[model samples]
Target: MDNIKLFSEPIADATPVIELFDVGMHYDSGEEILSDVNISINKGEFYFLTGASGAGKTTLLKLLYLAHPPSRGHIKLFKHDLHYKDRDAMAKVRRKIGVVFQDYKLIETMSVLDNVALSLRILGRSEKYIEKNVPSLLHWVGLGNHMHNKPATLSGGQKQRVAIARAIVNKPDVLIADEPTGNVDPRMAQRLLHLFKELNKYGTTVIVASHNTELVNTFAFPRLHLEDGKLIKYNAGSIWTLFDKKGDVNV
Candidate 1:
């Protein structure tokens, strides 16, 4: 844990994994994207967030992942009030969190194993430790034989799995995935979803966002629906019950 940053201040022993209190986001050009978003993601919870394009799902994820600060309200994670933390402290928080963007942000030049092991190296893990962990994780994600292969050489589903393995390699307490199954076939997409489910079973708080109705409908997890910067809850029988007057998602 040498490269892992220590918190600037210690926590008082009680806090949700993530707590957003009336949080909102406003752009510099006077556009409001999120308004009064108050939610708490407890430890080891699995949640799905689905909405149409530009419905603020990604924005909400960005805030939760600490990519950017909200324009209004407070965010607390692991009992650490983010408002009181500096940049250094934020980095530490990020270390315990893992994220998978829709774009599959992999190093095209690096082999699958190398790319997956990059994060551990960044955290100053010993060479022996990284060597032991990298191949093991690649195999876990079904990429062990392809360790020497780069991203461009892999299939869309394979790339997604590589991204997932990289995200979880550090053993983060939480994982956030945005449109992780968007580019693959239905069967492959289902496989990827199962990977997320398996990760959750291992005690990682998991949140996934996708506009894929058929895909999400197969699972009985709670869903957070978004529309025109507004939020709605998803329940049984139908996932499309929240598109009234606010917004609609065809998927």
Candidate 2:
């Protein structure tokens, strides 16, 4: 009922990186997980997605990453609508978006170099390019010498470093990370936050989903808060409402 259908209009010029209009999601056996969400994130903006456990924070990240279509609303990325986007089309768009999962989803069987290269190679990037980039990136994350080792050999923070490098190698338009620091020590977490800040400084739109309020508040960017599948401006005291003439748009 609102104008939030997600369709990318092309970002060859500067354009909003993400836009959600009247989006919602539900699962079988029947509870609504996310309902009527609307947000617009522009280039170089950093946002934190904050909510307690089971508040649908991760689920919303899944939607942004195109893991699932919204049940009723539109989801757009790079200015394009995405609800009916085909597998290949979606993959193309996804190539420009990086994701860091809370679980540190590094491939256990691969060497660190191989794992990091996998990200770039998946996007059809040349091996020569990956060879040059992975080392510098890993170095930035403090993993330069560990490239030949398997992920199993690294400590929690080291493993996280690998995940971060892999997620960012492509310099995607947007980086969506879920609890990226959950597995690291506080010191390492701070370091990684600075690294992400550096990435955002380089013009990557950054969205971090986490329960770390102290950290969220430490930075001044706007945040999205969710509870029981409903969303509102960060830490606000009321449910979102729509009073426009177009019928309550359901947020």
lDDT of each: 0.81, 0.77
Q: TM-score for every candidate vs. truth?
A: 0.87, 0.85
Tens-digit lDDT track of model 2 for 1-251: 11221123333325677888877788886788887777777887777788899889988999889888888878778878774548878888988899998889888999999998996777688978887777777777778789999988999888887888888877788899999988887788877788788777667888898788777666666667776676656423344343343222221
Give the C-alpha miss distance for residue 113 in model 1, angstroms. Answer: 0.4
Q: How many backbone clashes does candidate 2 have?
A: 7
Q: After TM-score superposition, what is the CA distance of residue 170 in candidate 2 from its true location, in Å?
A: 1.1
Q: Best candidate, TM-score-wise?
A: 1
Best by lDDT: 1
lDDT of 1 at 126: 91
CA deviation > 4 Å runs, candidate 1: 1-15, 236-251
Worst window of 10 by summed lDDT in candidate 1: 1-10
Clashes of 1: 0
Residues 68-105 of candidate 1 have per-residue lDDT tens digits of: 88999888888788954487888899999999978899
